[model samples]
Target: MISLPLLSHAISSCNGPCRDLNDCDGQLICINGKCNDDPDVGTHICGKNPPPPPSGGRGSGCSQYGTLTCGGSAYPTYKCSPPVTSSTAAKLTNNDFSEGGDGGGPSSCDGKYHSNSERIVALSTGWFANSSRCGKMIKITAKNGRSVMAKVVDECDSMQGCDAEHAYQPPCKNNIVDGSDAVWSALGLDKNVGIVGVTWSMA
Candidate 1:
């Protein structure tokens, strides 16, 4: 098993020299010590330092998270997401997972649509980690002092989007937790608010 020291070494090697996934070009991901086009390698081989939160609206303090243009609209997207913390910070956004819903298609993990009343979520690409967290339960805590348990059902793509599969929506941010209506209601948050700050952890 890889130790913390080895993980740290991998991260430093990626940033200082050219050894890990960050140094790879194109769709290749790091596995062991070589770059390969295997999605199953997962993303835990390297640690990503969190970029400071954007202080203003679009285009402000968004250099870390690059931009993508889709349907005449530019969206901010991240190549790398923040490392998980004790209470990993994230942005909770509304999502519809039922058939013919705004979530686009069947869930990535199970390939089935879930009801809005189900406490399910679609995590950002990095956290999704090639479906590594599929079917897992997580605890989400909102600022309103409410919390709920949600199951991981899909991935909110952070790398690529603006396609039919993605419902032409822009790529998701690296720290997003796209939750269903039940999650919001359980947290005592109004879905009309759209997005809100929250923290979560594996349950």
Candidate 2:
């Protein structure tokens, strides 16, 4: 149930501060504390106000987000995600920071490969804030009531991917906290589940 006045206000104020997705209008979404047009609005699946697909085309895969294909596989893409809060809700995904692993090149913050034994993470593009959060630590809390402190060592890019630098992976969802194995171990999570819901805040 959205109010017309709020929608009008949001439509009139692109880039204005927003508390969440409801504060945005039309195809706009909240990102990094502001409302902006979703870059993948029409292109991605499960997007708000999406236009109809081509008449005879196959449906978009996995009714959650857009997809990018590489090496004969489709990976999800997200141009905008939920706004950040003090205890920001995010998706925690696994990452291997060791050299020759799926993490690809060295970390963006320190240009080094960390061990899976280290508690580290890669934030999404917006929360990474152009490396502003680099080298900092965050507290992650899982649904099972376990928590751990992990360092921010890299960025799970939200804007660009499916290339050599990104290990041919798609752009990350804007609400990702790509954590190392040590972080999962500390939280007593089964990394085999792949992605899980979590809340995080600066530590």
Candidate 3:
């Protein structure tokens, strides 16, 4: 049977914590396993509280503690835990490219592989034309397995060994490297090559 507080017990006050127990009637105030009649019991906890640390999940720890490579070809496992590897990342380069209606020629990029390249400028030609391609991200891999993302720029028109405006001949000149000689020299592509492959996502 359960016990109910009498009319007199209801008016009593509890001065401490209330505990859950057997054989207690109504809201019993239990101070270290004892009950009181003071009404304000177990309400105040005084101290300073601090913000919580980040929870365990993807992308959170990296931002605070800086970036980390767990199972990359270079890092290859952190604390012996295998991370998901990207088996296929898009490749960018132009090699032996012929003139197409898209307006471009072959590039001297013979054996080079590039992925998402970063960019200095926020606005890029590809992205303005196609919002699907928002960022200037590129990744390149060397034969020795060295890979990094390069920045995208307005130099899509600045081909391997050419000027920025295709020597100002025609706006439709398919010669990207015709004016950007210095950049071409940097990439080590000769004028003989006609196509460079740049893989940018549509969105």
For each candidate, what is the lDDT? 0.77, 0.76, 0.27
Best by TM-score: 1
Over the stretch 38-126, how does candidate 2's per-residue lDDT look in tens digits?
56443422235654433432332212334444466555554444556678889999999989889888999999999999999999877
> Per-residue lDDT tens digits of candidate 1, residues 1-203?
74433444343232233356554432345556555443442222234543455665343322344445557766666655677766988999999999988888899999999999999999998889889999999999999888999999999998767767788788998889999999999999999999999999999
In model 2, the number of clashes is 0
Comparing 2 and 3 on lDDT, the stronger one: 2
lDDT tens digits, residue span 132-154, model 3:
22234534333334334433333
Regions more than 4 Å wrong, model 1 = 1-66
How large is the C-alpha RMSD of every model relative to the true structure? 11.0, 13.0, 25.9
- Tell me the number of clashing residue pairs for each predicted model: 0, 0, 45
In model 1, what is the error at residue 201, expressed in angstroms?
0.8
* Candidate 1 lDDT score relative to the true structure: 0.77
Sorting all predicted structures by TM-score, with the top scorer first, yields 1, 2, 3
